[model samples]
Target: MAGLELLSEQGFRLDGRRAGELRQLRARMGVFAQADGSAYLEQGNTKALAVVYGPHEVRGSRGKAGAAAGALVNCQYSLATFSTGERKRRPHGDRQGQELSLHLKQTFEAAILTQLYPRSQIDIYVQILQADGGNYCASVNAATLAVIDAGIPMRDYVCACSAGFIEDTPLADLNYVEETAGGPQLALALLPKSDQIALLEMNARLHEDHLERILQAASKACKDVHALLDQVVREHLQEVTALLGK
Candidate 1:
């Protein structure tokens, strides 16, 4: 909100992206052999790693003693000590982290076919390696890839993206600089194939009339991400099949 303008008059963002353009996306699946599944993803400058375990019996006192209906999903979200440039950082389990964890759990609950694993549980852990912005969106996307790596049945790929309205233009895939400018920010989690919404959250204030346009921009970005995820999953599966056949 200071000297830098969130959106330049030329319709370019601080990172040299068009108003509706997304940051460069780089991702890989099956990054951890020790876990049931894992993935690492980078969306712009924000990076995250996700690991999944279980779909076995639920664990700990928090879980029910006996098998219940549907699978339980537990998620832990953390920001690595050095994820942010600031030395004074919030540790794991901080209020923001906990809230984000719950958001992730809710997102997956809608996308995963939990009913198929009745009485079981799936644990997802995601750590933010870097935080330029869109942290939750990156984490959700990473978790979806990790879940897919575990060969879990899911209703659809859960793709997420963030958008903001600045300078009378809608911006997709916000970075830290735009985020701190304090415009009306919208975060969306989508089941792209079904055109269903898993989660949609907005912060700050925005006009009702402008909401639909911003949402449309975010949805388009999510669909684009879904296509990328599909490619990654297909490639990973092919490689695994080839190795297994050899």
Candidate 2:
């Protein structure tokens, strides 16, 4: 708030986005030929790649392969050593990476129709090639697109977004500067059609009175993300169809 103005008097954010406005989103599916499914996405300055594999036999010990009643879901989240302004010592294997990986697994487990592939395993790996803000949110959205490209069954499309509350206004899709402002922020992942929440996380506490408004703002942002992702999927399908005819 001191070094940078998060919200100007005109209601524009540091990046010139209005309250509840998301950043520019560009995405493509099937970016990789070998993986079962792959996607690359850019949300403002943040870029991520997601690759999905398996829905086949488990790789490790059967005891750790999970229950036969449902498929095992595994996720790994990594940030490139140079993804941020400061270089990282390791791409992963750290405490933050481990936590994000667990969050991703839980989010996918709630969305993917795991029962159909009982005793099998599905692996999703998300890497942050560039970091702005909303790293977790971008990862979720990209992973969802990758899963769709892989032809995996799911209850609905999963979408995610991050929101920050300041000056009694909710700012959607915060950038690195806004995120570092030390304000109350919320991250959400949702199955838009069913309005089911796959994950919800909050950092810094907001007044209870403003919680609902922040949630609603984040939910709307997720729907906006879903629309963009759906369009990308449609375009990818059309291209695939055209290639098949050739």
Candidate 3:
């Protein structure tokens, strides 16, 4: 790819992962006692934290209620000033952050069964501590675990992955270098068991012939992410159970 060193001669990616492999995923739910739900997740060097609150009565405007069936999902995505290699002046209110917040809201609104808690609001706040790449994916994955920890009912766990095409080869899980290389990049969020896509996005031009391969690669990567997330949730529950001696 132009301006990118996608694969080294050693057949390793910039992060040294074989094709179709994801970064190491580490996550913790209920990290904060104050928030109704909270989680911290690290995918390789990319780190993100999510806090969820409410499902209570609307806070600001009463007229904004679009549905009486359930709850309103409000999401705000922010990046820590030091999250990137170059420090950001503001945490949020930037164009990129605003767009990310909107995307997150849309993704969660699909997964969360909002109709169950009518007239209430669910706030999902995501903070990126480190941004190597795939910040949105990491945030969604972390938030899903947090929502589950809070015992919120949802359609399914939202697992996300980013894929890139390098030198005509579709690669799963793109890191910073691969992403910046300027090739077609695809981001997908899938409900693993259902094999349904909640969010599908792409940047740059990709041929139709490569679309299926790229989608398949992303889907498989999402499934792998789901497995890792499941393990994290189970481990957290085990710890909680041990503490309770149950």
- Candidate 1 matches the true fold with a TM-score of 0.96
Candidate 3: give the clashing pairs. Answer: 70-115, 70-117, 70-118
Model 2 lDDT, residue 51, Cα: 99
Give the per-residue lDDT of model 1 (tens digit) for 1-246. 568776678878888999888999989999999999999999999999999997988887566644477899999999998899887768658999999999999999999898888878999999999999999999999999999999898999999999999878889999998898987999999999899999999998899999999999999999999988899999989999999999
Q: What is candidate 3's lDDT per residue for 1-246, written digit by digit as tens?
A: 545567776668877798888999889988999988899999878899999887778777762567477788989999999888886498447998999899898899889999898888888999999999898899899899888877788998999999988877778878776777788999999999999888898988889999999999999999999999999989999999998995
TM-score of each: 0.96, 0.97, 0.95
The lDDT of each candidate is 0.92, 0.93, 0.87
What is candidate 2's TM-score against the reference? Answer: 0.97
Deviation from native of the Cα of residue 181 in model 3, angstroms: 1.2
- Cα deviation of 12 in candidate 1 (Å)? 1.3
On a 0 to 100 scale, what is the lDDT of residue 167 in model 3? 74
Instruction: List, residue by residue over 1-246, the lDDT tens digit for candidate 2.
Output: 576777899998877889989999999999999999999999999999999998888887863546488889989999998899896488346889999999999999999999998888999999999999999999999999999999999999999999989888988888898898888999999999989999999998789999999999999999999999999999999999999999
